[model samples]
Target: MQQPASTLATLWQIILRLIEKQGLDAEQFSRELGISAEVLRDPTARLPSRLTDRAFAKAEAVLADPAFALRAAECWHPSNLGIIGFAWLSSRTLHTGLKRMERFSRILGSRFSYRCAMEDRGLRFVYNHGRGDWDVGHAMTDFSLSILVDMCRTNIGHRLEPLEVTLRRPEPADTSPWRDYFGCKVRFGADEDSFLLDGETANAPLPTVNVPLANTFDAILTEQLATVFNDDIVSRCKAFLLRELTSGEPSAAALALALCMSQRSLQRRLAALGLTFQGILDETRHELARRYLDDSSKSVTEITFLLGFSEQSAFTRAFRRWSGMSPTGYRGNSAFAH
Candidate 1:
């Protein structure tokens, strides 16, 4: 399947960093991933998701680190953090930064969603991997949070450790390494995934120079961020698609009207982006179906109805096309397979 433009942009960034750090040329990494070096240079170039998986696998094989992907977080620079980091730096305090993170997190990435709340004596940053695949979602969240913590230290000129780091994966037998890295407590196999911050620590002051300069940086980063399409249109369409699909039926006409565009224009623009209305619908259905199947104990038939399929047969057919097997077969092959 075609990879999303955002995915490609991130892959480009990762490859660039790896090349810079390992003192290897792009040609070498491209040979490992079995792609041309030319293709990697273009930010807009498209590749299959499987290719990315293969590239990371090859990197792991060479690096001899199962956690190579996670370790990639350390390479993230301040500029790569984009608008999120800029906003955090501009904020008056760490508390404000956390609030902005909770509010405008879509600017960070669409794959993961976050929830922040003040508990009895601490602040909990709960992150939900909204992506369908558990492993991918978990990896993204882990890397993102790790980088966020590192950035906090950089911005504040002090190490502000989390009270507890909760993970969805099982606890490894050797916990000492994690304890050393996070500089606090680590809990695994939690009911929900979150990073806990002490209330006092979260309210601490950051050592940012020139708040006005930080604001300027935020604006520049916002404008520089790469997107698959225009931000406003994409955000609106995605929101509408998600809402309509959750209902019994979703229609393109209704969506077009809601977006203040005729159905014909909508189709034309989406086509220009190499997508169709049906493609978006199917993508939404497939993503939601996978999430429900993995995260919930709902029956297949119920999930079909919940995803707005008129009949179980139609849902089953679509599932096969998306996953190369029946819904039951896919579920059986999944990590959360029941």
Candidate 2:
């Protein structure tokens, strides 16, 4: 089963920056939204998608501007989007850059995706969510479209306007801002969210394109797709567990709370994926045991504590079952091999 949708924590940076620019309390606002300080500080972390939608809604409300999220997007940084940002920057053309986004859109959020195709007007880019809504109030839709145009400009080394843009957002009272922002035809109350790039603009070779770097990114991103965010809930669980194991005793309920799911819900999702809570716990402990045993300085008792085992005896039994050797024996063998 696919992991639940989450928003990239870095994507929230712009909204938080905009809030601070307005002289509001970013810390208080983040706390109110259930965003932890740790999540905000970690560039690679992710958060519940609703928290992102709520932050955007607050931005719109605070400024009395429905399109405030678009303004917030001006703060977007190349590094904010993570590795895909660099891959997009080094793309051979606007079209290839977009193709990279099309493939790794999940890095933005599990729900976010795009369709890149050719149409009569130009090469089309339509935004779609895994679920129906883009965000609670569709504020994220504007941010996404705004960032799309921004990305095109940065990649091509100019503010090249879209050939045309269509938004599902209802027409706001004023329209000029939309026009000024996109610098192209803007359609409101549209059937879907999309934009187009003319054939010439789409294929124009980019000066920033670096073939070697782009290929390297492609390989790394391919591995990420295979292992990281490709709907593998088990991997997510193990990552959280690895961080939490030595902090204190860990349990399925605690894991569920961290994952934003109920214990029953987590169990159901795991079962759907042909997994169980105990299976994941044991597997995580086994993997960590091997790593800890490889470190000669770490004693068997210390390893037991780190893996959350009740006692050295228990850890020894489990390690023997997993590796056919005691923790001490495994450590000796590893040290000798080195």
Candidate 3:
């Protein structure tokens, strides 16, 4: 299933707030992205992840700012993340709050994933594109880490600074914005994207820490997660596939492994739901192919790689079967339609 609409609203809340703060017209900006002005108001709405991606691109283009993520972080508030934000705020320490964020991160979106773990430096807070891997570009990686720092500053203390920051992307022409914002050593072209904090800083009690309240929110979040995943097997499968697709081509065996089920059982489960694994996989590819084609920055070859096609010709053939046109033709049509 697609990510909940409320998650997209959080992203828009940050982006639109930054736009307003910069003296830009939020409504006009929404129009530029071909979205409704009131899109963020409805909490139950679900939006295509590609729309969120386009909005980020739009903000970057309009503002001509490489520090767009930093600006958005400045405008971020706890409420922007809804229940997960509150659950985080009520945690006993920065480490607990981060753990809460990682647990309930699905409420944010399937497109983004996070990990909070211990590393050689200390407790490392790693944020990347895929949950199990790091394949996303710099724009999203920067925004995620920056806003996380914003969250830390808000809950722990404004003076809080991480031990070190590592990014997978190459260094930009100017690194001052990142260094100034992070207030630490920012390493680029690293093997992974992560933020390292000393053990003391991570485990230290927060000003707003409330164990009882945090427990209450945790219970509620647990219930919500159960309902979301148990409500539909198809949705759970779609979400899993979306995250795993970037690594390589999806297979029934791999999906079964990810879902912690035997191959036969997984197939039985899908058959019971009146669906097939290949059917779901094809649907996912169709949806993602169209979304990627809509992005002008993503060439057909890149989209092919992203969708896990071994060859561009294979992707084109698949696209032809799905859309009755070549990948390039579909992209041209998508551009005109938009």
Candidate 4:
């Protein structure tokens, strides 16, 4: 696989803004992260992902702040994404804009892939990091999702509250910031990182749609995607699960069929990669369970049905196994804590 590089222009702007707000020396921090201060002047230049990651790590360490990502996101503008952002603004609907963004996400950051799938409840915008043992940075996740939400709000011309927000990182001690920013339930320690937009909100026509301009950008993004063909199986499975999850929990055989492969072949491929089909199913369920549980709009019984449990008792037992508490108890605890 080709190594990923981030365009320095956007990153440089983010760094300078953070420095200005926090009263830090831009040159000193650039040197600390092995980034050339002069590189910030080149609009078309790129920085390797390793160097970018180091800079983010140093920012968290020097500032002694866990919410550094959140702060960065608040400053993010659609124009920061360059052409992709322009495409989103020109899109005819929130759905179209999101689809465009998801399609060309690698152009923004090759380390992550974006996928959008429709479910009974709404649309899920998933962010999957590339295969690696590298430490995942919460700040990057926060910044990315926040920028998505901000873009959606701009298009819709109103505050956009997601149905649910999920993070791969464990729940922080204080989730008030995330809750405040998203204006909805936030879940952590999920199988993957994603957020859900209510079906109605997701399907709503955007105020800024420009059919001609959107078509122009679409053509450009399609060409970009063809040049960087990413045939990632894990991302494909997650996208499938996002669609079929509400309908029912898919068995390995069903999933294999959905992926257009024989069950044996699927199992063999997963084994080669040191993974199992059942493990993926379980992890997906665990992640969805957290999201469903956090939504006050859904009752435990409704959640059981949504999760594909045959009965509420069975779901409660599984919930206990996952969280060390009964379904009701877990819900109550979350409510009290928040």
Report the number of clashing residue pairs per model. Answer: 0, 0, 2, 0
Which model, 1 or 4, shows the larger lDDT? 4
Clashing residue pairs in candidate 1, if any? Answer: none
Q: Whole-model lDDT for model 3 versus the true structure?
A: 0.74
lDDT of each: 0.63, 0.76, 0.74, 0.70
Which residue pairs of candidate 2 clash?
none
How do all models score by TM-score?
0.55, 0.66, 0.64, 0.63
Q: Cα RMSD for candidate 2?
A: 14.2
- Reference-based lDDT, residue 251, model 3: 85
Worst 10 residues of 3 by lDDT: 1-10
Compared with the true structure, what per-residue lDDT tens digits does model 2 show for residues 1-338?
A: 65777877887777777687767898899888888777666767888776666777676677766666676557788777878889898876788788779967877787778889988767899887544644444677777888888888887888888888888777878988878999998998887788899987887778887755775575566556545574667766776777677775589999889788899999999999889988888887875676565445668888899888778998999888987888888766622211
Q: How does candidate 3 fare on TM-score? A: 0.64
Residue pair clashes in candidate 3: 1-235, 5-45
Of candidate 2, the 10-residue stretch with the lowest lDDT total is: 329-338
Q: Kindly report which residue stretches of model 2 are placed more than 4 angstroms away from their true locations once superposed.
A: 130-137, 230-338
* Error at 42, model 3, angstroms: 2.9
* Candidate 3 lDDT by residue in tens digits, 1-338: 43333344655677778778778898888777777756676554446666766766666666666666666677777777777888788766788788777867766765667898887667898876663322224677777788888888888867778899998878889989999988999999888889998887787768886655665575566555545546456766776777677788888998889778899999998999789999998887876686566456678889888888889999999889987889888766522211
Model 4 C-alpha lDDT per residue in residues 244-309, reported as the tens digit of each score: 766877777887898789989888888988888777666656655764554556788888887777
